[model samples]
Target: MLSATPRTSLGREKHRGSTDRNDLYQVLDTGLVCHLGVVADGHPMVVPTCYGRVGDTLYLHGSTGARSLRAADGAEVCVTVTHLDGLVLARSIFSHSVNYRSAVVYGRARLVTDPDERMDGLRALSEQLVPGQWDYARRPSRKELAATAVLALSLEEASVKIRQGAPEDEDEDYALPVWAGVLPLVTAWGKPEPDPVLPEGIETPVHILRRE
Candidate 1:
C-alpha cells in the first residue's frame, strides 16, 4: 500500500509516478546492491550493501560492524536502489542531468528472529544476484546463519523517481555547435572465473556462462 505523493521533477517527465509496493519489489528484484540510510547519534549513516525483496518485505544482510543497522533496529530507516541508464549531456552543463531509475523505501527495520524466515530471506537474497543461485550454491548452515544479521523492512512506504531521454537545454542553445546527446550506460557480467581449488570436472554452470 503506497500513498500518493508529489511527483519528483524527473518523475513527471517519464516513469515518475505513483510507485506501488509491487513496482518497488520488482526494482529490488532487478538489482543486487542497495544503500541503507539511518540516523546514528543524530547523524545520517548510509551504508552500501546487498539486499533482496520477497513479497512485501525487503531484507538486507549486514555485519556486526555496521552502525546503521544497530541504530536502525525498530527505528525508521530508508533503503534505496538506483540504476543509472545514461548521462544526459546538454549543450550547457547547467541543463545536464542523468537518466536513471531509483526506488526508496521508508520503514522501521527489525531483525529477523524466526529461523525459517531467516533462511528463506537469505535464499531470496542469493537469488537476487543470480536467479538460480540459491539452488546452485550451498545453503547457509546453522552457525553461519547465526553469525549473520538480516534486517527486514516492509515495502508499504516507499517512493520511486526516474528520468529518461535527452537534456532540457534552452531552445536557442540548439544552434550551438556542440555535442548534445546521451552517453549510454549499462551493467554487464564478466566471464566466469573458476576457483583455483575447484573440482576438475566442474565447469562453469550455463546460467553463469551465458549471463548477459
Candidate 2:
C-alpha cells in the first residue's frame, strides 16, 4: 500500500486515488519522462527529465554541473510521472476532464557515489531509455562518468491517481443532446530514422525496429 502522508493524500476526488503500490510502479514504468520538483536557490523548480526505476528506487541522471541535480541531492524533492490516457468530454464544460495515470513520489534524493552502484544506476537509466542499446552502443568512458551526476530517490512515500472510463456529468446535463464520451489518446512509435552520417551498411538495430 502507498503511504498516506499529508502531501501524498488526495483531498479531492478521493475515489481516483490508488493505494495499491503496484499501480504506483505501473504509472512510473509506463511513462518515459518525469517532472522533478525541487527547491533550488529558494525557488521552486520543475524539470522534465528521463528516469529509470530499479526495484523501489528511481534514478535521475544529468550533467554534474546542472543546478537542478545539485539542489536535489541531499534535499527533499517531489517527482511525478503522468500518462494522459484520454479526454473526457461531458455534456457541460464544468464536467470536462482527462483520463490519466499519475504518480508522485516524495523523498530526499541522494547523490550516488559508489562506483559499482553508480555504474548500475547509469545502466538502469540507459536501459530504461533504450532497452538493448546499452549493449549495442559504446559504453561511457571514465571522463564521461565523472561529468555525470546520478540521484536516487526512494519510492517509499508516494501517491498514485488514475482516472478512466466515460465522463460524468450532472443528472440533467446527461439528458441533453450533447455527446459525452472519452476520446482515447494513443501513443505509438514511428519508423526509425538512421543518422545522416551513418554508414550505408549499418541498419537500424532490431530492438529499436521492434519497438511498438
Candidate 3:
C-alpha cells in the first residue's frame, strides 16, 4: 500500500490513484526517463535524468559538478516518471484527455559516498539503461568514479496514477454528431545506427541489436 501522507496522497484526483505498491514499481521499471525536482539556492529546479531501481531503492547519478545533483544530497526531492499512451478525443472539449501511467516518489536523497555502494549504484543505473551493457562494457575506473556522484532514495513514499480507455463524455454530448476515438501512441525502437568512427569489422552485439 502507498503512504497516506499529505505530500504523497492524491488530494484532487483520488479516483485515479492506486494503492498497490506493485503498480508503482511497474511504472518505474517501464519508464526510461524521470524528472528530478529539487530546491537549489532557494530556487526550484527540475532536471531530466535517468534512474535505476533496486528493490526498494532508486538511484540517480550525474557528474559531480552538476548543481541539481549536488543540491539533492540530504534534501527532499521529488522524482516523477510518466508514459503517454494515447490521446482521448471526446465529443466535448471538456472531456478530452490523455491516457497515461505515472508515478511520483518523494524522499530525502542520501549521497552515496562509500565506494562499494557507489559502484553498486552505478551498476544499477547502467543496467537500467541497457540490460546487458554493464557486463558488456568496461566498468568504471577509480578516476572516473571520483568524477561521478550518486544519490540513493528510498521508495517508501510514492503515488501511482493511471488513466486509460475512451473518453467519458456527458450523456448529452454523446448524442452530438462528432467523431470521437482514441489516437493511440506507440513507442518502438528503430534500426540501429552505427557510429561513424566505429571500426568497420566490428558488428553490433546481439544484446543491443535486439534490445527492446
lDDT for every model?
0.80, 0.93, 0.93
* RMSD of each predicted structure: 2.6, 0.8, 0.9
Q: Would you estimate the TM-scores of all the predictions?
A: 0.89, 0.98, 0.97
- Residue ranges of candidate 1 with Cα displaced over 4 Å: 5-15, 18-22
The runs of at least 3 residues in candidate 2 whose Cα sits more than 4 Å from the true structure, single-residue gaps closed, are none
- lDDT, residue 103, candidate 3: 95
In candidate 3 the C-alpha lDDT for residue 128 amounts to 82
Put down candidate 1 lDDT per residue, 2-101, tens digits, no spaces.
6544422234544464445566666677887998899999989888888877788988886655677788788989888999999999999899999887
Better TM-score candidate (1, 3) = 3
Worst 10 residues of 1 by lDDT: 5-14
Candidate 3 local Cα displacement, residue 24, angstroms: 0.8
Task: List, residue by residue over 1-212, the lDDT tens digit for candidate 2.
Answer: 99998999999999999999999989988888999999988999999999999999999999999989989999999999999999999999999999999999999999999999888888888888889988999999999999999999999999999999999899989679998899999999988888889988988888999975
Q: Poorest 10 consecutive residues of model 3 by lDDT?
A: 4-13
Ranking by TM-score: 2, 3, 1
